[model samples]
Target: MRQTWRWFGPKDLTSIDDITQAGAEGVVSALHHVPNGVVWTKEEIAKRHSEISTRKDGSASGLTWDVVESLPVTEDMKKQKGDWREHIANYKISMRNLADSGIETICYNFMPVLDWTRTDLRWQVAHGGSCMRFDIADFAAFDIHILKRPGAPADFTNAIADEAGRRFEAMSEDDKKQLARNVTMGLPGSTESMSLEDVQAHLNEYGAISRDQLRQHFIHFLEEVVPTAEDLGLRLCCHPDDPPFALLGLPRIMSTAEDYKYILDAVDSPANGMTFCTGSLGARPDNDLPAIVEQFAEKIHFLHLRNVKRDNDDIMGSFYEAEHLGGDTDMVAVIAAVIKEERRRKAAGRKDWQIPMRPDHGQDILDDLGRRAQPGYPTIGRMKGLAELRGVFTALEHGAFGLK
Candidate 1:
């Protein structure tokens, strides 16, 4: 696997020097300032490329942007409403621009409304460090009382609904506001924050769209852009829904292995693929992580190798970011599967055999809490994770596990 890091451009607290110092081979970033529907112009892409390659002293950073973490798919495109065709055209144009600049892998998502959700951005862990967490009861509390979406209560089981009510009643006004901000903390790359009204409006637009309808729209999207991607020799990978379940009464399509197989079958092409994120998929108790990797190895183009500590055995429940090797996922088995796939691809004489992977989310530990880098993206935290993952990769590659 090619080691990479997700950089949020110049405005990010984690600087280019930090990435290099951490020993990443390449970068994963995007023109985050660019809006969702706008075309990423050649000039803008060039500027970003220069930013990634050149440093403040005009010296080469000895790194290149390996992958576009995301090229935002707007709500209009997902719903197929309000100038969605134009958005699709702009998406194709962006793909062409990115390809022209030597980028071949793109990661995106089809989750509705918020790109991802977490009820607590800094939940304190037993180790005294903090990490992002998702408490189903807290989320339900926001949905039932704070956002007050219609039929929100019906979406939850009676036990969850009751627990949510208790939590809601216990929260102070400031607590409720913080929870709302945490839930709608904007997309990963963008700076814009969504107000409560903004979230409600987005939910309203999708009120009539069912899981099947939203899925077809996703396929339509793939149909429109996957051909262009194929022509450009670009790999388009869709990220699974975080937590891998429904939220705010919205339908989630890309949450399970079956979900991915369905979409992959729908848009069957080399250009269409999956971004295998262990943390996201592992949130669901039923998902066999290593099995899924083996099943879809050929279709996976990118990897987010973070892990999560699930609160319980339930499919939908709380989970917090766990250490790379300390979570529910069998990191050793997963890496073994990936290595096996790489061997298969090598035997087949494939050029793009190595997948690009990033140490996704890390706990906010050590000086990380003070540096206040992006929530889950701490300097020391991720460096620690990458170091651990590199150790695992080296052990597996050298036949230390007896795979030889």
Candidate 2:
């Protein structure tokens, strides 16, 4: 795996110095300042790269910008209606520009309403500090107690509803505000944000759409854009739905193996593929991690390796740090499978054999408090994650490939 770290760009508090010091040799970033549905010019891409390269800690030594965490899908594209043709065209142009600037992999997702869901951004970890996790109870609290979207209480069992109500009643005003911000406050690449009123209005817009309809929209969007990506020599990797399920009446696609099969068959293109986030898919026990890795290895261009602890049939939690050999994920089998795929590509003489992998989310530990960067992206946590993953990969390579 070619180790990479996601950076929010020049304005991000995690500077180039921080990233290099943490030992990431590549940056997974995007032109976040650029609005959705707009073309990203070569000059803008060049300028961003130049700024990153010229930082005080200096250039990305053995590093380069090779993957874009996302390029926002415009509302028109997601709805598969209105002036989406223009938006798709702009997306293609942006891909072309990114390709010209040496980016080969682009990570995106088709989840409607929310990009990723987390009940707590600072969920306390057993070791120390905190990390992100999704609690079903918290989500229930938000739906039936906080946001109070219509018919939400029915989505839960009577017992769950009762528990959620109790939890909601116990929360202070500050607790409610934090829960609201954690759920609706858009992250770095996400262009949309919601006030309570805005969240309601957004939900209202999806009233007529069903899960199947949303899937169709995603397929239509991919059919329009994947060919352009192939032409531009860019691999489009769609991230799985975080938590891997529907929430707050919002439809979810890309939550299962069948979803990936449907998507690849819908477009029938290698350029259209999966990012294979373990933490997302691992939230569901039904997903066989090693099997999925082996099955989709050919189509996977990017990987996010993290683990979650499943409490029960739909109730799960994640470890804050990406422990190379800890948590529920079988790190040995996962890394072995990735190496097998890389060997296959090497035998075929492919240049881009090393898959780009990142420690998806990390524990907010050490002296990382009050950092101004994006939440869940604290430096010390990622540094710890990187160190752990490196040790695992080193041992695996030595044992599996007879290389020390």
Candidate 3:
């Protein structure tokens, strides 16, 4: 795997020096300044690339902006409501501009309501700082109590509702605000935040669209976009739905392996691929991580490797900063599967054999708390994660080559 670090462009507090120091060879970023539904011009892409390339040696040696963490889909695109054809056309133009500049891998998600939900952005880790995580109870608390969207209580049982109510009532004002920010504030790589009115308006657009409707819309999107991607030699990797479940009255389409199969089957093109995110899929215990990797080995273009600790029954737990080998994911087996796929690609003489992989989310530690870095993208924590993954990959490669 070719290791990459996600840099949120020039506005990010963590400079290119910080990324290089973290031992990443490539940068995953997007033109965050550009609004959703607008075409990203070639000049905009070049400007951002040149800005990042301005390092101490007047060159970004190990840094190449090869992956876009996201090019957000407007609400119109998701709902397939009004002017979406125009939006999709603009998105295709952006992909073409990005590809013209040598970006081959593009990662995007089609989740309806939220991109990724976290009850706490500063959820404290026992040893030091914090990492982002979704607490089911906390989310329930928000749905049924804080935001208090109608019909929210029905989503949970009486016992769960009661617990959520209690948690909501007991929370301090600051805590409530934090939870709101955690949920409503769109993270970097995604678009801007929405007012309550904006969210309600967005929901109104999707009122007629069920999960099936959304799925059809996504399939239609792929049908239109994938051919353009293929022409540009860009692999369009769709990120799995985070939390892998429906929430806040929105539909989730890409939650399971079957969902992925449906997507590829809809487009039936190599350009339509998956960005295999372990933490996202691992949230649902039913998903056998290794099995999915082995099954979809041919279509996986990118990976976000992280682990989550799921408790028994319905009780969910915090995300631990587990070592690459220590997490719930059978990473050794996962790596072995990836290696098998790489070997297969090599035998076929494919150029993009070494997939670009990143340590997904990291625990916020050390000086990261005070720093102005993007949320959940702390410098030291990700540096540690990248280092650990690299060590694991090295050992696996050596073992494959029979190196003592």
Candidate 4:
């Protein structure tokens, strides 16, 4: 696996120098200042490339923009309304510009309104460090009581609804506002942030759209852009939903193995692929991570190797970010499956056999607690995770296990 780091452009707390010091070989980033649906001009792409490739001293940083974490799909495009076609054309232009800049792998998501949701940005753990968390009852409180989406109660079981009611009743005004902020905090490196009013308006718009219709819109988008990606020899990977389940009554189409198969088969192109995110999919108790890796080995172009400790046995229950190899998903076996696929591709003489991966998220420990870096993208914590992952990859590749 080729290790990379996610950099949030010039203003990111974690600098490019920090990424290199952490031993990452490449950088994953996007143009957060660019408005959604606006075409990414070649001049802008080059400016980003320049920023990543050089330091303040004008020396080579020895890293290139290896992957685009997101070239965001707009809200209009997801709903297939109001200039969605123009957005599609802009997406194609963005793809071509990125490919011309020599960044071939692109990651994007189709999660409506919200990119990823968390109930708490810094939920303290037993280790005295903080991590991002998704508490089901807290989320329900925000949905049913705070956002007050009509019929939101019908989405959750009676047990959860009652628990949410209790939680809402017990919360302070500050706690209630914090919960709302956490849920709609918006994408980390995007030019957008959503207020409660913005979220409620989005929910109102999606009320008339069904799961099936929303899915068709995603497939339609792939059909439009995948061909352009293929022509430019680029790989377009879709990030699965954060919790891999429905939330706030919004449709979640890219949450399961079956969901990925449906979209990949619909577009039926080499360019159409999956960004295998273990933490996101691992939140679901039913997902078999290793098996999914093996099954979709050929189609997975990028990897987000992190883990989550599910708070309960329920599929949509609360969960928090765990150490890279410490979560419920068997990290050893998952990496083994990935290596096995790499071996197959290597034997077949595929040039892109070594997949690019990043330590998705890490716990806040040590100085990380005070650094106040991006919620999940801490310096020391991620370096520790990357070191642990590298250890595993090294041992497995050296035939430590009997597989070879």
User: How far does residue 156 in candidate 2 sit from its true spot (Å)?
Assistant: 1.3
Residues forming the 10-long window of minimal summed lDDT in candidate 3:
312-321
RMSD in angstroms between candidate 2 and the native structure over all alpha carbons: 2.3
lDDT of 2: 0.80
Candidate 1, residues 1-404, lDDT tens digits: the string is: 99999999999988888888899999999988888899999999999889888867888999899999899999999999999999999999999999999999999999998888999989999989999999999999999999999999998889999999999999999999999988897486754558999999999999999999999999999999999999999999999999799888889999999999999999999999999999999999999999999999999999999999998998888999999999999998999999899889989998789989999989999999888777788989999999999999998888555467
**What residue runs in model 1 are displaced by over 4 Å at the alpha carbon?**
399-402
Off by over 4 Å in 3: 187-192, 313-325, 399-404
lDDT of each: 0.92, 0.80, 0.80, 0.92
For model 4 the local lDDT of residue 348 reads 92
- State residue 268's C-alpha deviation in candidate 1, in Å: 0.8
Over 189-259, each residue of candidate 2 has an lDDT whose tens digit, in order, gives 55234788877876887877888998898988888888888888889999998878777788877888988
The ten-residue window of minimal lDDT in model 1 covers 185-194
Write down the worst ten-residue block by lDDT for model 4.
Answer: 185-194
Instruction: Give the per-residue lDDT digits (tens) of candidate 4, residues 1-404.
Output: 99999999998878888888899999999998898999999999999999998876888999989999899999999999899999999999999999999999999999999889889989998989999999999999999999998899998999999999999999999999888888888674743347889888988899899999999999899889988998999999999999899998889999999999999899998899999999999999999999999889999999999999998879888999999998899999999999999989999998789999999989988999998888788899999999999999988888555358
Q: How well does each candidate superpose onto the true structure, as a TM-score?
A: 0.98, 0.94, 0.94, 0.98
Going through the candidates in the order shown, the clash numbers are 0, 0, 1, 0
Report RMSD (Å) for each prediction in the order shown: 1.1, 2.3, 2.1, 1.3
Candidate 4 wrong stretches, greater than 4 Å: 188-193, 399-403
